[model samples]
Target: MTKNKAVFIDRDGVINEVLTKRVKFVNKPNDLFYLDKVPEAIGLLSSADYLIFVVTNQGGVGLGYMTEEQLEKIHKKMKIDLESEGGEIQDIASCIHKPNEGCSCRKPEAGMILKLAEQYKIDIDKSYMIGDRDVDIEAGRKAGCSTIFIGKEDNTVDANFSFPTLYAAANWLKSTSNL
Candidate 1:
């Protein structure tokens, strides 16, 4: 059986405009905003036979800033919006544990990607992980996948590629990869 290649994307900061800085995390469903050309990018990867998964670390739920139900609402909206634009997300894996909880599924820990790799029969070596944070890149490295970092901040991430936005990265992947 051949393993599928995947593109694991970080939800906040990468796909959605997150409330960062002093107050991080979306407090309400309306707080979630889509970044530019997210659906278009997803579509490109999908057309290239890449399974797209949203891998996020939402510690706000565990920190009492938001409830699981609230987060679900936000995710539902995102899915609906993206799907309406002809994009599909294969799955979503989130680690809602607090920063001090010692969870393995958080960014910088490859547990979530590792589990998804087994469940989806994915080849991590052929996979790509795109995120806007250093921790996200670290997780991809730990998961044995090449990474693309999206953001204007200093290049603190150890990614194979760096782009200003997800769309740019997706375009590059489609053009460069045989997949």
Candidate 2:
């Protein structure tokens, strides 16, 4: 089978506003909010024939801060909202294990990416990972995918590109891909 191409995205700071220092999980569906220009950004990427997948580390679930059912509700609502804006998510893979647990599915480990690649038959060489943190870039690099760091500060990772926001990353992808 032909390998698929994908864009792996991080959830918290990349998709929604980051509530730093807050111990809250987006436990409820109503708590989900897209960052400014996020909808349009996602719309642009969706139009480019890229399979959009979210690879997030939600350790709060394992820490007992939130329930799995609650997370499901939030994700369902998120998918609905994004689809309403002409954005589509092919799948969402999450690492619910805590950092101390030494699980392989977390960011910087490339476990989730590897699993997704196997499941979707994805071509890692043609894949891109976009997020707002160094861990995101590290994971992408470990998985042999191009990395795009979306943040004002330099991530210091050998990322393929950097953008101030998801919208900027989307624009870059659109122009670079000529889509």
Candidate 3:
């Protein structure tokens, strides 16, 4: 059976604004503002028939910064907003483990993406992972998916592609996937 192509996205910096690298959690639903052109980019991806999945490391739930219920609410709001803009995300998978805990679902680990790939029968090679951090790139590579780093030159993690923003990367993904 043929598998579907997909795009795995990071939550903090790719989908929503990253207030600061030091503090990486949307504690309140009110804090979940997105970067410019995010919804438009997502809509483009969706229209191009790429299954979109949000893979995030929301350690705040385990660290007591926020509750699981609060995270759910935040995600609910995100989905509603995205749909309002004509974008649809197939699923959302988050790792609630702390950074110190050697959890497989966290960034830098491909567990979440791998599991979702299996469940959704996704073609890892045909899929793209879009993220802003080094760990995000690492995870995508480890999962055998193309990685797009949404930042300037970063030596720690080498990505298959690098763009300054998710919108730019999404445009590239759309054009490249057609080839």
Candidate 4:
């Protein structure tokens, strides 16, 4: 089987709006808010034959701020919304451990990506990871994938490219693919 190329996306701040009020995390489907251009951006990448996946850290779950059931509800809603707009998510993975838990699947670690690669037979070198934080970039780098950092967030390390939004990154990928 040919190895598949994927576009791994960070959940919060990239797909949904980042929540800052609770200090916990997005604990419900009601808290999930899709960005304006997210569906289009994801669709554009999907059209280019990239399998889209989501890799997120939900420390809130481990901290008792959110339940795994709640997280699943939010993901189900997100997938429905994205699919409605002609986008598809092949898989979703979350690291539901706090920083003190020493989990290997969290951002800045390669556990999640490595698991996905093993499960899907993905080509890590050809895949790309897009997110809005330094941890995301670090994870991508550790996973041997190209990285795109979204938003004007302070990512003073390890990102292959930085753009203002996912749309911009998608445009860059689209343009580069034609070359």
Alpha-carbon TM-score of each model against the true structure: 0.92, 0.93, 0.94, 0.93
Residues 1-179 of candidate 3: C-alpha lDDT, one tens digit per residue: 87999999999988887676534558878888888888888888887889999999999898999999999999989988876667789999999997779988998999999999999999998998988898898899999999988977777768888888888888888887778
lDDT scores of the candidates, listed in order: 0.87, 0.85, 0.88, 0.86
| lDDT leaderboard ranking | 3, 1, 4, 2
Q: Any idea what lDDT model 2 has?
A: 0.85
lDDT of 4: 0.86
TM-score of 2: 0.93
Name the 10 consecutive residues with the lowest summed lDDT in model 3.
17-26
Better by TM-score, candidate 3 or 1: 3
Clashes of each: 0, 0, 0, 0
Top candidate when judged by lDDT against the true structure: 3
Candidate 1 lDDT, tens digit per residue, 84-160?
65668888898989987998999889999999999999999899989988989999999999999998856566689
Q: Which ranges in model 1 have alpha carbons more than 4 Å from their true place? A: 20-24
User: What range of 10 consecutive residues in model 2 has the weakest lDDT sum?
Assistant: 17-26
Native-to-model Cα distance after best TM-score fit, residue 157 in candidate 2, in Å: 3.7
Error of 2 at 27 (Å): 2.4
- Quality of model 3 by C-alpha lDDT: 0.88
The total number of steric clashes, by the backbone 3 Å criterion, in model 3 comes to 0
Q: Which is better, 2 or 3, measured by TM-score?
A: 3
Cα RMSD for predicted model 3: 2.0
